[model samples]
Target chain A: MSAALEALQQRLGYRFQQASLLARALTHRSHGADHNERLEFLGDAVLNLTISRLLYDRFSGSDEGDLTRVRAHLVREESLHRVALALRLPEVLKLSEGEARGGGAQRPSILADATEALLGAVYLDGGDAAAHALVKQLFGELIDTTTIDNWRKDAKTELQELLQGKRLPVPSYRIVATHGQAHAQTFDVEAAVPALQLSSMGSGRSRRAAEQEAARQLLDKLRAPPAR
Target chain B: MSAALEALQQRLGYRFQQASLLARALTHRSHGADHNERLEFLGDAVLNLTISRLLYDRFSGSDEGDLTRVRAHLVREESLHRVALALRLPEVLKLSEGEARGGGAQRPSILADATEALLGAVYLDGGDAAAHALVKQLFGELIDTTTIDNWRKDAKTELQELLQGKRLPVPSYRIVATHGQAHAQTFDVEAAVPALQLSSMGSGRSRRAAEQEAARQLLDKLRAPPAR
Candidate 1:
């Protein structure tokens, strides 16, 4: 076994009888036939559930919305990817030569997927409790509300309520156009509500992003209270 | 505040400044205007995150998929509803007179929603940490793996893989007939792959269930070991 792999096992407090699962977990699709896609799928669900339960326990009197926001923050792709990197996951990751050369190890999506796949491998090898322990130990500190609450609110929810509080009709969004090919499409969205005509346009790789941008624009506009 | 509410607060190991939120959390939308829809939404997210984190910590070697299954078992609507009832959540629930007479307080959906809403109210009152503590206290015992392992696997997934493993064509499902009104439907379905055909009928509020029933029948057929 490679020294890096051995060190990783030590840090994670686990030793794999079948190291192949670990290898598969760390192998991204870009690495070729033996990839971590299935593991990633399983890990994603596991991560969400584990973190969710922790937050639920820690925040005794919290509302579901707040808990949702905190969970999102704790399990965000960026955060998971960061954890993966901290474990020196990149050093052990078996990627295609081209991908390794292209800095695939540093990619957020790849790192996040690999982390989840690693969790999957753990579960498969040792069972649910093992996976839960691994994830909790890594994320327990992050669950601190002081850090999570700092960035919980989303623009769309706030903007929607801002209008609704004023007895304004709920905003409606329309996809005006799409630019680019299927895998890389940029959407143009227009958000409108009859009571106030605020025309804002947003562009993103997906419709959701475009809508979020449009909402952000509306928020900026609405934040400026009308002049008397 | 009602004495039932006070007893519940003591059991939860927390006091509510705004007892109204707790009352609202226990009130289902089916009951009246002062229901727990918003709180339920918030609580659902919180529950997911907290559980996810805990599983992650407890199971260092486990992956996301196993963790997800475990969490799903822990937080399924039925499970949450049971927990809500165990906490005596229904006693203080404010319901429309008609719903109260109808025993709406004991309904599973209502109980589940109320549990989520209660989590939401707690989060709102005391923030994420507070909500986490409450959920953890209520559900800490659920983390036992032996209990989680006993959960039935989704029959659909099992049947899908069974066909795939044998290198047969992907199984296809067809709804042969439907009987009953729009509110509650009964369906007869057939699930077939090249070498095997299974048919079964089921009644549910939706079509997915009918298909699941058909898949379940197929599972039964495939249960017997094949000649080596």
Candidate 2:
């Protein structure tokens, strides 16, 4: 193994029985034909299950919705990227020259996918036991420190659930505009409920966030007392 | 033990060490506050991971997308409901008086959730070995019968993947209209690729199917030669 890979293995706390699997996990799609996409897919399932299991065991009093919310927060791209960064995955990532120049190694989505790929590799190299153990080890602190109370449903989800609970027609969101640079774009979104004759607008760095913001504003409007 | 519970265990092919878990798994939310929701949550993760592992091992040559598509088909509500029906789950299901009178046991969603809950109960009552074995046994035939070639990418997924591969902005789907009776609603969906200045229209019995049909039509347009 190369010095870099050896170091990465140390950080992962896993010695791959087949080092090739580890190598494949680190190879991004931008790098070549054979890459980490499949591994990332597998890793994603594993990560979800691991986190769900952990949450299930830890939060005995919590309902399924509570468990799902906490698990979602734990496994989102931001959280996965943080985990990847903690393992210094960017140092070991294999990217194409173009992607490398484009800072692919530092990209959150890339890092998150690679992290999942690594977990996939771990599962493949050592089976469920190893994969489960590694996930538990890596996420133990996060699980311990995190509380379900800290997880509020994102605006869109909250709105949808609320409407569903009340047997109200679902709200809709649409992107009204997109502008600025590709890397730093802004999206203007509108949230509407035709049944309620209400609409609210919000803008953010991404379409999802913008939609979420719109939902938040719309929810505010929904909850407000009527003006005199 | 009741004869009904015993027969249900016989059908499941595994007797629970903790009968209470089995009882809880059978209980529906409508039954009472203490229900199978938590178990269903845990079981969902277990089912996802189990199917993922199975697919990974079975389809060594399939791409991540293929694996994902197949897994989605395998673990969907319909498939889970089929599995539950095969086990004669309706005969063993526990529902509140109102739900029972409303035919809750025969409901696809309820049957599916109960199936997952049963798997969760098995995991809790036995452990990983037993859970894995049960899932393997339950899904083995279906896994053997289903072919990757038969699992075509749904229109929406195909469109999304194609756009992603081309580094183009993703398409957005909106429900333009929903008509007909509540029990037999028809949804009119529009799929738009704003960057491409293209849109397609489709209508179906459900919003998702309608959106998918619109996407399919759009893809056909994208893939065809320009009309004279």
Candidate 3:
């Protein structure tokens, strides 16, 4: 095995019985016919299950909705991308020349996919125990440092609670504009708190999502220190 | 244990070490403080992983996309509802009197959720081996009986292929209408095969999804036998 791969295994804290699985996991589809998409697909599920198990045990009192939200926050591309960067996946991923030129190695989606592929490979090579342990090693720290309250409430709810705590009137949301055809439309919403002269705009695939985005933006503005 | 519970165990082909877990899995939110939603959440992930693994093994030659489509079909609400019926979930699910009167037990979403909760309960009760074995017993026959061809191709591709097979002109898809605001738009698409004087309309969250639905409807119409 190459020194890089040997180092990767050491970092992963799990050795692959079949090194080829690890190699495939690090391969991008742009490289050749044999790639990591399948592994990524399988790995996504493995990661989800492992995370669900972790959250289930950690927040024993949390309801299913809160668990789902927290899990989503943890497994989203951004989180996985951070994990990939920590693991230095860019150094190991094999991408085609064009993809490399395009900075595919540093791309969040590619890195995240590779991370999942690696997890899948670990699962296939070392079974459930190894995969579970690997996931814990990769993500347990993030979950540990963050409080469940960070993700338990939706942005709108959190915004409302924050405003209520500060003796501020609730924000009002209005649909600013609609786009697309009858069946596939997007909502652009404006959230305004006239009392504080704060307003923000957000767009999403659903009215609720858009409202939440707007509320989130407003909350961020409220939380930020006043301009110097 | 109640006779009904005993019968359920016989059907599931696995016995829960903790009866409370099984009871919780069978209990809906409306039933009281204890419910199955948490178990359902965990079970959903377990089911996805199990199904993915199954497809990965069964269709070694299939690509990730094909594997995903097949897994989606197998684990969709409709599929789970069918499995729940086989397990007689409606006869055993614990729901409030109002929910019972409202037919909660037979509702597809409720039944499906219960099925997943049951799997989750099994996982918690007996570990991965028991959970995997239970899933195989519940869904193995469905997977074995169905061919990958049934779901490998998207509806649009399948429709196009069918038309081409008969030397018919390819279908044209046009956006009929769009609804909602800038963020959460839905698209209504009309798919037409002028050669066959057939057309269909379908709607979805995206144009591609709408077009596929339209194509699926057209395909169904074409596949129907000619009237006498």
lDDT value for candidate 2?
Answer: 0.89
lDDT tens string, model 2, B105-222? 9999999999999998998888777888889989999999989978967778889999999899999999999999999999999999999999999999999889989998998788
TM-score of chain B of each: 0.66, 0.69, 0.69
Candidate 2 docks at the CAPRI level of incorrect
Q: Which candidate do you rate higher for DockQ, 1 or 2?
A: 2
lDDT of 3 by residue, B1-228 (tens): 899999999999998789999999999888876889899999999999998898898888877877888998999999999999999989999888878888988899999999999999999999888988988888999889878877868889888889889998889999989999979999999999998889999999999889989997997788553332
Residue A216 accuracy (lDDT) in model 3: 75
Candidate 2 iRMSD, 1 decimal = 10.9
Q: Which DockQ values do the candidates obtain, in the order shown?
A: 0.11, 0.21, 0.22
Candidate 2 has a DockQ of: 0.21
Over A21-76, each residue of candidate 2 has an lDDT whose tens digit, in order, gives: 99999998767767898898889988988888899989898878779989989999
Query: Which candidate do you rate higher for TM-score, 1 or 2?
Result: 2
Instruction: Give the residue spans of candidate 2 off by over 4 A.
Output: A152-228, B154-228
* 10 residues in a row with least lDDT, candidate 1 chain B: B144-153
Q: Which of the predicted structures, 1 or 3, would earn the higher TM-score when compared with the native?
A: 3
